[model samples]
Target: MLNMKVGESVNEYFARTLAIVNKLRANKGKIDDVAVIEKILRSMTSKFDYVVHSIEESNDLDALTIDELQSNLLVHEQLMKTHVVEEQALKVTLGESSGERGRGRGGMRG
Candidate 1:
């Protein structure tokens, strides 16, 4: 949702991302599978990595006179979006899996 046009400082985008991630975490209960959940959390890091590399390789940075310290702020923003989307998708998958597990066990106990 934090769609900024050209020349938007990465810092602004990053703050918005952190807000959203916090909101999501606040809503969800402790996930049962820490390993799988951790993998989902890893998406944020991967997104940051991609964004930093992209900006570093961008024409905006390459021709710069200054030693551009690649800010992962905007990268974090993009990563947060990806993380939310993936988290939702995984939740759906887990819900379905839980349903299947119940059916496999012959439904609820009396």
Candidate 2:
């Protein structure tokens, strides 16, 4: 079991979790926050009090056994897809706003 010092604060634990999440996101070629949820899930019970809350809330570990890791790759893939969707949505919204502003300006004059 992971052990953490008794005086460690929750905020510090969360910060560590965020760092791990960011690292995982970087590995997947995305630089966004979508992976945060999953990272939080993994951080729970991390050999210390900093463990993520998600895992504790679920009360289910049978599904997380090593034998199940391969099957769970699909879940990771879906997470990546979700990140792409969010990134694309942000891009689309920004583009639309820019276009509207351009139209409001009555087009560019030569």
Candidate 3:
């Protein structure tokens, strides 16, 4: 069982988990889809908690395949990336605005 890291990307986490699952299968061990799905939900980072909750509340997890869950997560991952980029851009704009004000006051004092 792989534990998800706080800063780990979804792609990395999924790859690690999939590797483990593949190893188990190669060894002829029987794995339940429900158990794997539940493990994934439980192991996800806090950032994904909302997505997990939404999935659990709106869909039948038992009926959802691993591929389906991964696809949903991929969508959220893209959203997260976009949100982060937007936030960084906003911060840069705000920083520049504040910087201009500071420089203007400094020039007047000189």
Q: Which predicted model would earn the best TM-score?
A: 3
Better of 1 and 2 by lDDT: 1
Query: What TM-score would candidate 3 get against the native?
Result: 0.82
Q: Per-residue lDDT for 28-98 in model 1, tens only?
A: 84433333222322333443556546554663442432113224354467667798999999998998887
Candidates 2 and 3 compared: the better one by lDDT is 3
Deviation from native of the Cα of residue 83 in model 3, angstroms: 0.9
TM-score for each model:
0.31, 0.31, 0.82
Question: 76, model 3: CA deviation in Å?
Answer: 0.8
lDDT score for residue 26 of model 3: 82
TM-score (C-alpha, index-matched) for candidate 2? 0.31
lDDT of 2 by residue, 1-86 (tens): 22223444444445565566567677876744433444434543333322334334553553353223323433544565698899
lDDT of candidate model 2 versus the reference: 0.49
Q: Evaluate model 3: give its lDDT.
A: 0.88
lDDT of 2 at 64: 55
| Model 3, span 54-74: residue lDDT tens | 988988988999989988998
Q: Looking at candidate 2, what is the lDDT of residue 106?
A: 55
Give the candidates in order of lDDT, highest first: 3, 1, 2
